[model samples]
Target: MNAPVDIAKMLQPRPVPAAMLDALKARFGERCSTAQAVREQHGRDESPFEVPPPEAVVFAESTTDVADAVKLASQYEVPVIAYGTGSSLEGHLLAVQGGISIDVSRMNQVLRINDEDLTVTVQPGVTRNQLNNAIRHTGLFFPIDPGADASIGGMAATRASGTNAVRYGTMRENVLALEVVTASGEVLRTGTRAKKSSAGYDLTRLMVGSEGTLGILTEVTVKLYPQPESVSAAICHFPSIDAAVKTTIAIIQLGVPIARCELLDANAVRYVNNHDKLSLRPAPMLLMEFHGSAAGVAEQAQTVQEVARDHGGEDFQWATTPEERTRLWTARHRAYFAGMSSNPGCRTVTTDTCVPISRLASCIDKAVTEADEAGLPYYIVGHVGDGNFHIAYMIDPGKPEQRVLAEQLNDQLVHHALSLEGTCTGEHGIGLHKQGFLVDEAGAATVEMMRLLKRALDPKNILNPGKIFAL
Candidate 1:
């Protein structure tokens, strides 16, 4: 087990002066809240850190509202954290340093849709499902899905990618432009509607995965795709997890262009079956989707089926109808909740490590072995087509030893991944949880450069202080 750092000592909240609170309340009237319930809601996220709530919450309804609140905080030299739907898993929304949370949930709006250019502009609070529904009539859809009905701004902040990312790419590739509120509350625009640019630094890309440390995203313009002419979904059972992973690597190696390739171990399948009230074989399985022309979809499916069969896949089934496909995916999307349902009142220490395609099998195998040896309740799921997987260890919140064991397992897994030239996190950003691993993965000099950049942009260190790296 790695030596544990003193997390409590690292998170010291700055004073939120009464004058700052008064200024915020005066500027926004009833929109600024100091209610304990609201502050508590804005202070925490899906992470398991125990920190003091922010002094207040500001529900921003527009870009101007966000700018004004940020400007006030900047004047007071207090920390500011941005909040969306609160779906982030890496503690991105936690009020580690006391200040205010700029809740952008009220800014949900699809400002413009350029169907001719296959682009859509939206406010920060617009969700993936909401965006797709808003543009459904135009036969266009946003393909980046992080599986939490996550807000676009939050997704951009984390540079999230999910099932469709294997073919369509992540927020880093899809986001074309951003309207950001800098630390001084200055609204800056980056990128243009044109497909490519070489005029200056790619500031849009910089803010996409900065995790609210650099700035707050107010508006986003993202690329969209035309609805496929033919779409097909399927499920194939494998004899073991290794066989399932092998099949996925083969599919990707062959350049099959599979839209979604997800893996579920027997534990995950059982949880989803009991929770979703559906009967599925309690075995390792691959849930896949292919999108293209009718003939192209057929060819892709056939190629995948052959690869799976060669690796001992069985019970090949297809969901041709829209309803059937929805049922399966909805269940998959709810797998995290299902896992929680099986172990009520349990806190999970989830690991997200992505490796090179050729190294994925060894990485996952070592993880499964380590987890089994630890004797903790756990489950496995992954976007295997892109070489990313999650192994969530469910531990009792009241038992300190259990958490220690889980963290030890996580540490071992992350080091193993780093040894294989993989990242500490695949989709989830480094908020409060993986700061130590970031140093190990990127080394001290690289992380120092990041700190320098943060200090340079936010001299006051008021924008999301104590995140990504220490100031």
Candidate 2:
């Protein structure tokens, strides 16, 4: 016998029962919102994709509040998705399931700064720049940067890496612990402030990149770095991009403990110099930073210069003043926007991937060649030390054939990464955009296990549905 379709049971506009609404109003008062504008705005983040509006938004102010809200959500059978600073590159915050978005921004408070232990405890909504600024006077700094001012929780959830990842590592290394609210409304503490442990499960790591599929992160304890005593910057130019990329590969193979190693292709250079109104070499370029004692930094800078010179790189230009370095990196960080500016009236499709350091030059060369052959407008750059880069292709979405060609090129790049024993995504998690590709990257059994975990934890299949996988 066929099961009843339940179309009428599910389709009748079942609004939130007044009892649940009353309970929420009691707890949050005006903080609970049903306003269409606010609900629709909370429904999505930075993803350039389609998503449905959420039913409501809750500005959570405490872990206890989070627990209470989740308990109610579980009882009411309403989905709950965690919201931090809406800055994910992937479509992580899309509310396809249509439920509640637990806005954690109200919980943005730095609770504890254990300078002795070199760790800090903070509400999940605390952003990288906000945390760093708070700790600046303490002679300690948090270094997990992701370009934008993303929340610590979001960064941890995505295993976000950025230009400084070459030195400090990603959220994988920085996050020491978490306070998570399980799907069943249970609060669990994972990991600890201790540096090393043989602790079972490594639940901390499991939660680090969960992306709200497994549980909701409420608070984070992160490791901190002692403020470097001295830092120096060096900018060098190469005759060609291949030469610049080759030099970066050599630096990594030679094992330089330098802080930052970023590459900006000639295209990126032209855009930034024009947009930011700064005079810079319109050639393949590498900007580096050395951190340590003055003597040690000077020596390392010299060593890097020698390596670059051997690969047809130019003289190393130094930027010692804070103003100089900031101006340089500010220009570097805006490289993506600059790429968009290269061609007026266009949108950017910023696709990212990582590879073994040895294969970077070849990978980038092939990708660039493919783009050139397709006659697409694009710019490419990355943290060369990590063998990860983004090719921001500018195209008119209205052009049907061009969109297809862009996706074709993207697929080719992903296959290239996989063939080289690298991941399809290095920093950006497998959100909706890369759902189909995750299986190819992790294999069927691995993806199945991931799905099984998702089902076991969120049996209702209400949390961020149709994301990463579909029924």
Candidate 3:
């Protein structure tokens, strides 16, 4: 392990500016809260990191409200952190530098849906499930599914992708435009509904994964897809992780156009079974889905089944009905919560890494071996179709040593992925947890260029201050 670095100082909370508080309260009235409960709730995220809460919370109902809050914060030079449903795995919403949290949950609205053009414009607070439900009757669906019913704005900010990302791509591809409020409280529109554009700078792509540091997204426009006429989902068990990964590689290499291919280690299966109360085989497993016409779906499934059998996979458990498919996916999406329930009151420190498709088997094998040797309580799951996976280290938060061990394990795994030409983060962005890894992955020069852009765009550093990189 590398030498321990002192990060406590960096996590220290800054004092709330009195003038900023008064100004916000005056402008937002009851919508602005400094109450203890509200502040506590806004301070941290779903991650295991404990942090000081924001000094205040502003429930923004429109773009104007967000702009007003940011303008007030900029005047005081106080940090402005954007908050959604608080589902982020990293410490993206932590008030490390105390400031105001602009909660956009009230901004949930489906502004527009261009069915013919296959695009939908929504307020930042709109959840992915909500967007899909609103468009379900139109025979169109938003393909990105990051498990948690996370806000679309949050997903875009993190550039999240999921099981379907192998085919539909991540937020980077789906998001077509954004209406963002800059640090200075000015609104900037990026991109358009047009499918492709080589126009000027790709600002939409830049803001999609900026993690709210560059600007606060008030609106997002994303691509939608026509629902497949026939859908099939299945779960197949593998003799070993190696076999499971190899099957996934073969399927991807063969270009199967599989919609979803998720992997769960034996440990993960056991925990989910105990927590979700379903009897799944205690082995490396793959939860797959096929989206196409009936004949095409059948052909794709048969091909994947053959590939899996070649890798020593067992008979598949099929979910042919929509209800059955939903149940199976619900169990998969709740894997993190099930992992948390493994040890009541235990917190999880998670790490994700994505390597080239060919190197995934070797990368995961090393991680599993090292983690088992450490004997730390954990769960492993992956979007293996795209070579991205996560390990959740279940640690008793009261034990400082356990947290230390978990961080060490995560660091080792990230460095291992980097050695294999992989990225430190796949879908999850560089929040507080992966700041160090960002430098290692992107190199000093590239990070400096990013810093220059951040400074040029947000001169006061009030937009999510102390994130992505230090000023």
Candidate 4:
């Protein structure tokens, strides 16, 4: 493993020449700033390492503004880091190349909601919570709920997915089209509103998870699902981890269309109990939700209950009321943050691996055992139904050796997952953190093909550079 450098350093802002700063000030006025506070906010993402910030932050208020900034950036030969909700888990927003930071928050607006077509067109800065609140009265909802109130563009860039992913699928599936500003400042639309097509190259799909490298996603069109007719959620306790894994695998094999099937280890349960102020037992637990018509949900719940019973699972304490369900899901969504709160003055290091239903148990079993042996302070949680899991490590930043060990263990977990014909990342795209593993996961030829495509789209490397690829 590479020797650990200081990964927790805050982003440092680069200084632009007076001529450039004056030009930017003339161009954007109050929207552009060289102040340290603003630059700091624009520089770092939610990732571990912090690097140099851009010379200035330019708040672009519209797609045209973004195109203008890109044109200026192309002329200046400077880095242009697209900023969204600042919730990325990788070092995606770091201005490693040093130039201008395009803060997209000002551009937030819902362009269109085609109820008949069941899709929404939104600007890059519109957040998930904001979008949901806007459409709350419409009876249709966007279902890709990543933990944070992340921007749609950022979520698309990262290819984020969460609890609902088991039911609604990830950005890769929901994203129908994108309006993008290329490296050369050309504004183009990739895909049509059609649900399915075999017409041309899959540019829409390609741009969905590009992490703002090939192009800056200015606007996005995503499919929406009709609100669930009947929604029911519950918590199920298991006697052991093995029992929980076995039951999860059984649910998948039985083909139950559960909306969410998440596993929370005893440690994670303890974290939530402390953070959310709940008094639940600290055992391996499952937080599940089922959606459908009343009769269908009832039948599915009954079958699930039976399977749980056979696997040493406990009672299903249901949450029927909207408030109760919201409270429950809110707790689940902040499970990792809750884990972090359990340790004062420490940050979280997350590791995720996904495998097939047949190998899920083996992958998680070994990971837990390895974490235990390493004496790591971490909590295990996951969307277990899809055979994917995450380990949230609350590591002390003062200790570099420990962080290296954590990374090594994570590498091993990825190796194990890949051994089962799984992926290193189930939802999180191959940002800077996962770049090295991409080659091993997708062989040399495939990696070469990916590089060629990236080159074709972003020959200048002015978009999010040094992400996924070494260049």
Q: What is the lDDT of residue 314 in candidate 3?
A: 95
lDDT for 23 in candidate 1 is: 91
Candidates sorted by lDDT, best first: 1, 3, 4, 2
Native-to-model Cα distance after best TM-score fit, residue 420 in candidate 1, in Å: 0.8
Model 4 superposed RMSD (Cα) = 2.1
TM-scores of the candidates in the order shown: 0.99, 0.93, 0.98, 0.96
Candidate 2: global Cα-lDDT? 0.82
Among residues 3 or more apart in sequence or in different chains, the pairs in candidate 4 whose N, CA or C atoms overlap within 3 Å are none
RMSD versus native structure for model 2: 4.6
Candidate 4's residue-wise lDDT over 1-471, tens digit each?
A: 422333343233333557777777888899989888899888887666757667799999988889988887776666688999888776788876677889999778999999889999999899999998888778899988877889999999888888888888989999999999999899999888899999889998888888888899999999988888998988899998888999989998899999999999999889898999988789999999999999988888999999999999996798889999888788888887887788987767786878888898889989989989999898888988888799877778898777788887888888888989999888766676777678889988888898888788777667776677755
Q: Which ranges in model 1 have alpha carbons more than 4 Å from their true place?
A: 1-5
lDDT by residue for model 2 (1-471), tens: 112112222222224556777788798899899899998888766555545667788989999888888887777777777888777766788666567788998788999999999999999999989999999999999987777888888888888989889889999988889999888788999998999889797988987777887788888999999988999998999998899999988888888888899998888889999989988989889999889898989888888999999999995789999999999988998886777676777766667889999998889999989999999888878888898888877778677567667777878898888889888888988776676678788888888988898888788665555556564
TM-score for model 4? 0.96
**lDDT, residue 51, candidate 2:** 58
Of 2 and 3, the candidate ranking higher by TM-score = 3
lDDT of each: 0.92, 0.82, 0.91, 0.84
- TM-score of the candidate numbered 2? 0.93
